[model samples]
Target: MISSISTNQIKYVLALEKTGSFSEAADLCFVTQSTLSIMIKKLENQCNLILFDRKSKPITLTKEGEELINQLKLIYQEFEVLQEIIQGTNQEFYGNLRIGIIPTLAPFLLPLFLNKLVTNYPNINFSIDEITTQEITKRIKTRELDIGILSLPIEDQELIQTSLFNESFLIYDASGTFSRNKKYKIKDIDVSRLWLLEESHCLSSQIEKICLLKKMDTSKHNLEFKSGSILSLLELVNMNKGLTLLPKLATLQKNLIKPSYIFNLVNPIPAREIGIITHPNFSKKRLLDILEIEIKKSVKPLLDKTKRIQLINPY
Candidate 1:
């Protein structure tokens, strides 16, 4: 009976599970609400179990239904893998590649290689999202995302990580508080006048660690502000006479911020290791190789080749 279930039926069920609404799921699956409902009911009848609680307002799966959906997702992923395998055998890269990048890296990093990738691989379909580190790892593990580009080292042992490049951190002092001619050490930073992204961002945490923000006294400032965007952070810094740490890539856009406002860190410069992460069983090696090559080529010339560097952990 299980063998009799069609791929379309599986897709219907998965879509319903994801959207938690018959109408929304129907739209996602490109089917009528009635058709989706009938297919799911049929699937449930065949198994002699009620998969969804129809009485529930947005619809919810039962305990047994949850277990069944878990297995169904695995089966669906395997089907995708089989398709990828066939495409790989043809020696042609033509398939969907779902990519998630952390917000801190997404803005600065995507601009470096996205256009080249899209132009070079016209056959590949790229779906990219700016997601947090935790969400990226979760989606990759669930086979929802093909790859993640973010700062390492992630604690997940199930994922395979490939180091892409080391991006150094620089001080963006809009108030001209720090000397432009000299490299500033972490100890020279005044936490009271420092602004940062909200604590949720990994970049914010990395900055905190590098500057020892937790240990410093920030109570002197009457107004406390934190932003989710580097661009916003820069704006606030400029308006309020505050400073924030920015990744090297963020400072490269000369039109966005003046060269006089950007300052370098002292010797043994703090940097973050950016990398691509994927599940252990991820296929499409050729696609990954090309992506890595293009990204490295784009950023190699932009990044400083100096040997004095210290890698900051994102965790």
Candidate 2:
């Protein structure tokens, strides 16, 4: 009776499950292709079952193999969680946290919060990916990232969002050409003068709603660039000459040169809701909770607390 299996066997099985090719899985596992095939054969023999249908294109798992691999994945994730827990206790915040941040927020927001994270939890290491909101959601759902910082109303039932702060958007126009009026109405926007991030960014969609720019109207707007970072857009505005919406967080510091050409939208204002997002099944709940608390604390001082803001539903 074959009663024993090794951790090496499990690793080989998982590698095959991911790559769907024995040679690829073996390369990933740092073994010969024949070695991986032999290990999988041994595992199946031990259980008296076929784990994979080798003849199937792309290597489909057998019915029993599918269920077994599902359990194996859970076991592997749990093992990681246990390893983190043990490591986290000895040192303040030990273990790597893989996080994804939306591009618009990453540049302005990370510097504000990272220092405190390092000071408080020096043992924790970070693997950060700055990506678009769409990418963040996809990666989080696939278990590639532990947390995502995104502008909310993220509707995915598979993820949970913690509202961290409500930041306002200021309507901006080319300085001398348009009034620097504290409150410019939506209808009053010089639509022809408006500059926008290219199509995919959620920020672009929110800007369309905020400025009341019809889809066709945006199509008519001449120069189009696909960037979500307000800072870069601001530079473009300064050089190329056009108006764009900016997050309040981008404007908080006096050092950020507000090109002598800028204006704010009036009452019935527009804003974006920034929040911490995590997969519902994220393995590091305690770390996320700690991160949320720290981020909120850091952001409170940077905000213009006097201004009223609105949260958009992330459809």
Cα lDDT tens digits, model 1, 91-183, are 476889999999888888899899988876778899998988999999999999999999998999889999999999998887777875676
**CA lDDT, every model vs. true structure:** 0.87, 0.77
The C-alpha stretches of model 1 lying farther than 4 A from their native spots are: 1-91, 215-221, 224-226
Candidate number of the best lDDT: 1
Report the Cα lDDT for residue 219, model 2: 54
lDDT of 2 by residue, 1-315 (tens): 667666788888899988889999999999999999999998999988898999987887999898799877777777779878866774765788988987777878888888877766777888889988889999989988989998997878668988888877776555456654445666776766677766667777787777555562655545666566676677776665667777777765567655444456556556788898888887777888888888888888877664645555433
Model 2: residues >4 Å from true position, as ranges? Answer: 1-92, 180-182, 216-224, 253-255, 259-262, 306-308
What count of clashes does model 1 give?
Answer: 0
Give the TM-score (vs. native) of candidate 2.
Answer: 0.66
| Deviation from native of the Cα of residue 187 in model 1, angstroms | 0.7
